[model samples]
Target chain A: NAGVTQTPKFRVLKTGQSMTLLCAQDMNHEYMYWYRQDPGMGLRLIHYSVGEGTTAKGEVPDGYNVSRLKKQNFLLGLESAAPSQTSVYFCASTALLGATGELFFGEGSRLTVL
Target chain B: AQSVSQHNHHVILSEAASLELGCNYSYGGTVNLFWYVQYPGQHLQLLLKYFSGDPLVKGIKGFEAEFIKSKFSFNLRKPSVQWSDTAEYFCAVNVQDYKLSFGAGTTVTVRA
Candidate 1:
């Protein structure tokens, strides 16, 4: 069904470089989220979009930026790659189901910054 | 701020053994709880969720969780486990913001 797809599954970047991770979903969900997964840190939210053209910060939003110009796509960008930012990033979306919606997640993007 | 905790970092069991994973969340208001499972090299998938009404909720793969409001805990349990059940499990809490606060996760290994 191609529920949620992420581009550039793996990437290696040098410190101070920039890159963007693209998340696309065909489900047409209204809420989209970007999260980074690290060892022992679980999955920490980086950014999220409630709807088209609306973006908000999450728990770990310091080194990341996100935009949701379109409903089906959410873009996460790294302005300046840092070694501490090396982790696996995931994208997720959920349809409006009141307070009990479940998240559908993408495969994830693995990033390594040296 | 809302947060979730998974006490068991790793658990090892043989096939057909019972399973129990502890999960706790810190929030004063009403919340929606969820358990997600991630298989090796796979994305996270919902195992089950608790919204309201019944305190005990059942999920896929014969998994169930009980929501004890007084204890602020939502523990996942299964009567029997298979080798294929080996995966990483995570507990998450949503305080009506649509943003999930996830626990560190517990790794389960089922030996055949």
Candidate 2:
């Protein structure tokens, strides 16, 4: 059902370049999140949206921005890529916030900044 | 800020050996706990979760976890392990139903 889909499965950007990562969910969920996974460090939230037109900062929001103009899509943007920002990004969605519903995650987008 | 901890960073075991991975969270109030597994080159999949009732929860692949409120711990266990059980395991906590915080994952390697 394409529970969660992330675009640009892999990308390489030079320092100071900009790019956007797209996440789409067909689950009709209300909560969507962007997270980065690094070696040894599990998954850290970058940004999140409770619903369409609403977005909020997460634990690790530096160097990134997010938009949720539509309920099914959440976009994470890196205005200026940095070596530290090179990590695997994941998108997740849940039917409800603060509930027991499990998160549906995307395969992940691997970004490398040089 | 709330935080989650997974004590075992890397674990190796022989096939059929029992398994246990320790997880602890720092929060006093009510919380929802989750255990997710990531196989090689795959997305994170929920193994099990605990919401309100039943501290002992059983999940897929013959895995289970028990919630100990006093200890603020939710430890995962399996009676028997297989080579296919090798994967990275994560412990997550949902506080106030708003944000999910994840622990530094534990990598389990099972030798057949």
Candidate 3:
């Protein structure tokens, strides 16, 4: 099963450019998320959606936007790219249970903002 | 505010050596713990998780972790390492609202 997939594995952007990263899941999960990984910074949450059409901000939501229009897809957008946004971005989704949560992650999108 | 920490920034070991990596989270209430591995040029995959019931959870690839509630720690361990075990490991804590806080990650290098 192609549990989680991300499009455009690598991309380079100029400052102030806009771009979108697409994430798709085939497991029919209810929760989707966006995270960025940097040296010594871990994978900080950028945005998340509980279900289709519902979005929420997480620990680090600045300079990023997310949309979940379909149950199987979540999109992350960078309105104005900056050097700070140059990091490996990962998309993850999980099936919702009562309290416990488990995640299935995509390969990742390597973005470079020059 | 909740956060996760992985103590080992990097580790090098010979094949067949025992492995232990420390992970800790800062959360007052109930929390979900997870260990994910990212092999070179690959995606992150779940190694194991701790929800409840038992403190120790075994996952694929002969990996396991012990959850010590009093210590607020969930340390990952493997009885023996293999050359194929070289990868980056991440520790995470699932907080309320289904958001995961990940650690900085530990890079493990196993020499064949």
Candidate 4:
């Protein structure tokens, strides 16, 4: 089964442009998250949804927005891309919350903003 | 805000050498710790995790970690390493909230 899949595996955007990264999970998980991975920053949470129709800000939510219209999908949107946003984005999903659950990660979407 | 810290940014060792990567978290109280590995051009995969139990946890690829509550540390170790062990390792912590904070990551390079 494809646990987590991220769309637009690679993208290049000029400054001020907007784009969205799609994350779809077939695992029927209840929680989903968006994270950005930089050279040394590891992974920083951008936004998350506990379930369908529920979204919350994460550690690094600025400049990014997320929507969980359906339980299977979580979309991360960059309203206006900036050079600082040039990083690899990852999507993750978990069947449960807290320490008991393990997160399944997507392959990642590499975005470059010029 | 809780945070995870990985002491080594980069580590290089010859094959068959013992390997250890230090990880620490700032959160007190109960916590769940995790170690994730990312091979070149691949998605992050679970190396190991500790929720609650004996404090010593073994994971895939002959890797293991020890949880020292007093020290607020969860260090990963492997008795012997191989060239295929080369990858970026991350330490993560899950507190009460659903959020999981990750460390800056440690790049391990095992040479043949």
Candidate 5:
């Protein structure tokens, strides 16, 4: 079973361009999250959803928006990309949050904004 | 505000050598800890996690971590390392309100 899958494995966007990264999961999880991984910065939360149609800001939420209109998909959008927004984005899903259950992650989407 | 810290930015070890990567957290209340490994070009996978009960948790690939509440630390350890162990490891802590804080990560290289 495909636990979590991210679209656009690699992307390059010009400054001021827009794009959306899609995350899909077959685990039927209740929680989904978007995160960015930087060189020495590890992973920082960008946005999250507790369930379908709900989204919340995370640690590093600037320059990004998220939509969780469906139970199995979470979309992260960049309205206007910037050079500083270049990073590897990851999508994750969990059966439950605030619980001990583990989170399953997608391969990741590498974005380079030039 | 809770935060996670991984002291080692990079680590290199010979095959069959013991390994330890330091991870610390700053949270006062109850917390759940996790260690995730990201191979060269793969997704992040959980190595282990700590919720309650046993502080010493064993995970896949012979990796384990001990949660020391007093020191606010959950350190990952492996008895013997191999060339395949080369990867980037991350430590995270889930505090109140269900947000996870991750460390800067540690890169481990095992030379055969």
Candidate 6:
């Protein structure tokens, strides 16, 4: 079964351009998260959703918006991209059990802004 | 806010050499610790995790981590390393809720 999948594996955008990244999971997890991976920064959470129609801000939520319109999909959008936003974006999901659940990650989308 | 720290930024070792990566967290109370590995051009995968009960947890690829509550540390260890073990390792902590805080990551390069 496909675990977590992210779209647009690589993209290049000009400053002020807008784009959306789509994440889909077939495991039917209750929690989904969006994170950006930078060199030496590891993975920083951008946004998260506990369930469908519910979303929350994460450590690095600025300049990004997320929506859990469906149980299996979480969308992350950048209204106006900036050079600083050029980083690899990852999507992860885990079960409802808080402490015991392990997160499954996506292949990651690499974005480069110029 | 809680934070995770990985002691090494990069490590290079010969094959069959023992490998150890230090990880420390700032959370005082009960916490869940995890180690994730990312191979070249691949996503992060679970290396090992510690919730409760046994302080030493064994995971895939012959990797293991020991959780020391007193020291607030979860260090990963492998008896022998192979060239295939070259990858980036990350330490993560989950205090409450499902949110996790991650360390800066340590890149390990195993020479043949």
Residue-level lDDT tens digits of model 6 in A74-114: 99999999999999999999986365658899999999999
lDDT tens readout by residue for model 2, A1-114 = 778999999999999999999999998999999999999999999999999999999999999999999999999999999999999999999987566658889999999999
Q: What C-alpha lDDT do the candidate models reach, one value each?
A: 0.94, 0.95, 0.92, 0.94, 0.93, 0.93
Distance from true position, residue B41, model 5, in Å?
0.6
lDDT tens string, model 6, B60-100?
A: 99999999889989999999999999999999988868698
By DockQ thresholds, what CAPRI class is model 6? medium
Distance from true position, residue A42, model 5, in Å? 0.2
Q: How many pairs collide in each candidate, listed in order? A: 0, 1, 0, 0, 0, 0
TM-score of chain A of 3: 0.96
Error of 3 at B57 (Å): 1.6
Error of 4 at A109 (Å): 0.2
- What TM-score does the A-chain of candidate 1 achieve? 0.96
Query: What is the alpha-carbon lDDT for the whole of candidate 2?
Result: 0.95
Q: For candidate 5, give the docking quality class from DockQ.
A: medium
TM-score of each: 0.98, 0.98, 0.95, 0.98, 0.98, 0.98
Please give the range of 10 consecutive residues that has the lowest summed lDDT in model 1 chain B: B92-101
lDDT of 5 by residue, B36-100 (tens): 99999999998998889999999999999999999999999999999999999999988746567
When just chain B is superposed on the true chain B, each candidate scores a TM-score of 0.99, 0.98, 0.98, 0.98, 0.97, 0.98
Query: DockQ, in order, for the candidates?
Result: 0.71, 0.78, 0.63, 0.78, 0.75, 0.72
Once model 2 is optimally superposed onto the true structure by TM-score, how far is the C-alpha of residue A10 displaced, in angstroms? 0.2
Query: Which pairs clash (backbone N, Cα, C closer than 3 Å) in model 1?
Result: none
Residue ranges of candidate 3 with Cα displaced over 4 Å: A97-100
lDDT of 3 by residue, B1-112 (tens): 8888899999999999999999999998988888989999998888988888899999999999999999999999999999999999999887665678889999999999
**Could you give candidate 4's per-residue lDDT for residues B1-112 as a string of tens digits?**
9889999999999999999999999987899899999999999988999989899999999999999999999999999999999999999998867888899999999999
Give the clashing residue pairs of candidate 2, or none.
A98-B97
Task: Provide the DockQ value for model 5.
Answer: 0.75
Per-residue lDDT over B4-102 for candidate 2, one digit per residue giving the tens place of the 0 to 100 score: 999999999999999999999999999999999999999999999999888999999999999999999999999999999999999999886667899
